[model samples]
Structures are given as C-alpha cells and as structure tokens.
Target: MQRDYFDRVHFWGRISSVTALAVMLGIPLSISLHFGIWPQAAGVLNGLLKIIPMFWSIAVIEVLTYAPLLGAGGTYLSFVTGNISNLKLPCAINAMQNAKVSPSSEEGEVISTIAVASSSITTTLIIAVGVLAFSPLLPVITAEDSAIAPAFKQVVPALFGALGAGYFSKHFKISLVPIAAGVLILLVFPALPVGTLIPVTVIISLLGAHLSYKHTQKKEKKRQNQA
Candidate 1:
C-alpha cells in the first residue's frame, strides 16, 4: 500500500510540476504572440545568461534542502503554489510539530500536504482581496510619514525571528553551528543572496545535529557500561 501510494504521488507530482512550468512559460509566450513584440534573441540570451545561473542553482538547492522536511506531496504543492520558505514551509513545520509526526513518516506526509494546501488557499484568497482593496489602502500604507511603515517592512523578519526563536531555544546545541555560520557569512559576504544562504545554513545545521546526536549516544553508552 505504501509503495502504491508513493507511486501515485510521484506520478501526480511530476504532472503538476510540468504543468506549472508550462503555464509559467505560456504567459510570456502568449503575451509576445498577442503583441507581435517578440524579444531579440541576443537580448533574451543576455538576460538568461545573467539570471539562469543564480535561479537554477537556487532551484536545485531549495529542492534538496526542503524535500526531506516537506515530504513528496508537500513539496509538489509548495513548488506549484510558490512562497515555500516564508509561508508554506512555516505552515508545514508548525503543523507537523503540533501533530507530533516525523517528516519521514506517512502521517507526516499527509499533514505536511494538508498544511501546504491550506496555506496556499489562504494566500490566494488574501491576494485576491488585497488586489480588490489595494487602491483604497494604498494611500494609508504609502503615506510619507506612515507610523506603520517600519512594521510593514519587518513582517518577513518578524515571522522568521519568531520561528527561529522557538526552534533555536529548543535545539540550541544543534542550531549553534548554523546560526554562527549564518552570521559569519553575512558579515563576510553581506551581498550573498538568501537563495544560496539557506542551503548552506541547512547543511551546517545537519552536521551540527549529527555531531550532537553522536555525542549524546557515546555519553549514554559510557553511563550504561559504568552502571
């Protein structure tokens, strides 16, 4: 049954990913066709040359870093719906933590998928409403001396800060290396993009967690032998 379930997931996941890619490309293609304003090959190539390396590298890194935590279904949904790091990821992680499920387990897969789906739906609805109401709210939000300007700018940082505080507080030993490395990287290479930074931090965190686990195991073994 598990095998069959996974087979189905892979089938649908691939379908969804390909379809999303097609749709994404279709929009620009359609626009060019309708306007009869196709871009020059040289211009297109130049743009791709600049962005492809950064975008493609980040794409691969995100898949590697997020797949283990999000499970198959969640990953497919997240990649399609977008906003994985800021919204879907936090939702899935919080859901799994609340449900007390391991991400590698079937139960976790279901929970993560559901969480991502919920986040996607909520985000879509919010975007739709915001679009409708944006004109009315724009003036207040964009006022030169708006009191909430700083707060608005801090939203992403606040979200990550809250999540980081919770996780780091609980797993300080394992988080130490990643946190230190992240700070050092920022200090040394302040221009590093977040797409590259995330995977590097994740790798360091994994190594730190592994070492911490091994140390605990050795201490337990020593105590058992002495007893």
Candidate 2:
C-alpha cells in the first residue's frame, strides 16, 4: 500500500532521529560503563538546571518559528546537522531562490535538501583538507606575528556586516526599531544571561516587525481610500 508522502517522510525522520539519538547517547553511555563511572547526580542536575531553563524556551521558539520554513526532511536533517542560521539555511534559501522553487512546495524541499547536503559535503571536504594541511598551516594561521591570524578573527564580523547590510537594506523599516532595541538592551544590560537574552531579543524583533508590517498596511489602505 502506498503511504502518504509526509507519512513516509515522517517514518524515515523518526527512524533516523531515533537512530541518531541512540548513537549520541551510546557514545557517552559506553564510556561511562567502560570507566565504571557515571557523571555525578548533583553535577548533572546543576548543569541541566542552568541549561534547560534557558535553552528549552529558545528551542521551543526556534522550532515554532523555523519548522514551517523547513519541511520535514529539511527540518530533521537540519536539527541533526546544526548551523541552520549561518550556513545551512542560507544555502538552502539561495538554492531555492536560484531555482525559483516556492519554499512551500515539494520541489523546494528537494532543493533545500540537496543544497544542505552539498554544503555539508563541501564543508566536510574543506575541513578534511584543512586537517591534512594543519601542521603546515598552523603556524601561518595562528602565530601572533602572522597577519593571517588577525584576518581570520575579522571574518565573522565581516560576514555579519555583509549579511546585515543586505538584510537591513531591504527590511530597514521593520528592522530598525528592533535593532535599536537590541543594542540598547545589550548596552544597558550587559549582564543579561545568554539564555534570557536570545529569546527576549527574538521577541522584540518579532513584535517590531509585526508592528512595522501593520503600520505599512494601514498606510497603504489610507492612501487607497484617499485615491
């Protein structure tokens, strides 16, 4: 019997997810058993207490926000693969855009999957090559006297600047208030814990964008009425 397409995806996704989770758990479990030692209960609880309270909300928010954009396969693969924001997502989006595939369509799912796969492959190969070359390249890249080391440090900011310029140019109106708010929040509350800060910033940004969109709609309607 032919199953629905999503049913198949869901089936595979669950199997893959479970297998991956098992493998991840297996490694530490094996080590613990081999060493005849387990992590301290208090240590585990303290770590979990700090992390879960902060991260659980952010995880929920990310799942709610990104799941519709990333279909079943992409979502599953992305969760396993990580780097959704900076790498996988942008590559998938660019592939979909270049192919003129609507994100909501099956074709877009294939395109996104292919794009992320290719990106992962390329990243892996690059890392492999870097590993092979590391002994020779290490001094050149890491020496305090090496100019290249400084350049590597700047790469992240340069990337953010380029991406920020592109995004903000298009979304300046909807983004400006949130951007300002985020900066102010950071400046005023430098001690804000990461777990609290991320979700708060995201909420602020979402609210700002929504209000901006509504304001623009209202302005358009007013103009149309006057016309």
Candidate 3:
C-alpha cells in the first residue's frame, strides 16, 4: 500500500510539473502570436543569457535544499505553485510540527502535501479577492507615507524572524554557523543576491551539524569508557 501510494504520487507529480511548465511557457507564446510580434533570436538569447545563470543555479539549490523537508508531494506542489520559502515551507513545517511527524515519515508526506495544497488554494483565493476588491486601495497601500506602509514592510521579516527563532532555539549549536556566516557575508558583499546565499549557508550549516554530532558521539564514547 505504501509503495502504491508513492508510485501514484510520483506519476501525478511529474505530470503536473510538466503541465505547469507548459502553461507558463504558453502564456508569452500566445501573447506574441496575438500581437504578430515575435522577439528576435538575438534578443531572446541575450535575455536568456542574462537570466539563465542565476535562475538555473537557484533552481537547483532550492530543489536540493527543500526536497527532503518538503517530501515528494509537497516539493512538487511548492515548486509548481511558487512561494516556497515565505509561505509553503513555513506552512509545511508548522503542520508537521503540529502533527508530530518527521519529514521522512509517510505521515509527514501527507501532512506536508496537504499544508502546501491548502496554502496554495488560500493564496489564490486571496489574490483573486484582492485584485477584484482592493484595486482601489493599491495606491494607498503602496504609498510611501501611508499609515500601514511600515507594517507591510515588516511582514516578511517578522514572519521569517519568528520561524528562525523557533528553529534556532531547538538547534542552537547547529544554527550558529549559518547565522554568523550569513551576517558576515551580507556585511562583506551587500549586493549579493539572497538566492545565492541560501545554498552557501545551507552547506555551512550541514557541516556545522555534522561536526557537532560527531563531537557529541566522541564525548559519549569517552564517558562510557570512563564508566
């Protein structure tokens, strides 16, 4: 039964990912056809040359970093729907924590997928409603001097800070390396993109965790010997 479930998940995940890619590509193609104005080969190549390097690297990094925590189904949904970092990941982590399931377990896969799916649906509905009903408030909301501008600016930071605090408290030693490295890197190269920093910190954090675990094991072995 477990094998059958994973088989079906893989089948549908691949299908949906491909379909999403096609729909995304089809949009610009359709627009160009309707206008009878296709971009020149040189122009397209130039644009891709500028974009592909950064985006391609980040795509690979995000997949490697997020896949384990998200599980197969959740990873597929998060990638397809976008906003993995700020929304889907947080939702999935919170759900798994609540359900008391490890990410590698079958229960975690189900919970993570459900969390991501629900977030995607809720996001879509919110966007639709905002577009239809809040169009008039866009100017107010976006104005630099608006009353709520300060609060809006802090939303992403506040969300991440809250999540970071929880995780850091749980894994203080392992978290220190990445936190310090990230701060130092940003201070040294302020222009560096956040996407580029993600994988660097992830690598550093993994190394830190490995070393911490090994040290703990060594101490345990020494204590056993003394006893």
TM-score of each: 0.91, 0.73, 0.92
* Deviation from native of the Cα of residue 87 in model 1, angstroms: 1.7
The global C-alpha lDDT for each of the candidates, from Candidate 1 onward, is 0.89, 0.76, 0.92
lDDT of 2 by residue, 1-227 (tens): 12477788889989988998998899989999999999999998988998796578777876766666666777777777677666676677667767888778888877877887788778778778888978687777788888777887786577557666766776777767766787788899988864456556667888888887899899999999999
Q: By TM-score, who's the top model here? A: 3
- RMSD of every candidate to native, in Å, equals 1.9, 4.0, 1.8
Q: Per-residue lDDT for 26-120 in model 1, tens only?
A: 99999999999989999999989998998898889899889999999999999988888988998899889889888989899999999999999
Question: What TM-score does candidate 1 get on C-alpha atoms?
Answer: 0.91
- Of 1 and 3, the candidate ahead on lDDT is 3
Residue-pair clashes per candidate: 0, 0, 0
Give the Å error, residue 198, model 2: 4.3
- lDDT pick, better of 1 and 2: 1
Task: Candidate 3: give the clashing pairs.
Answer: none
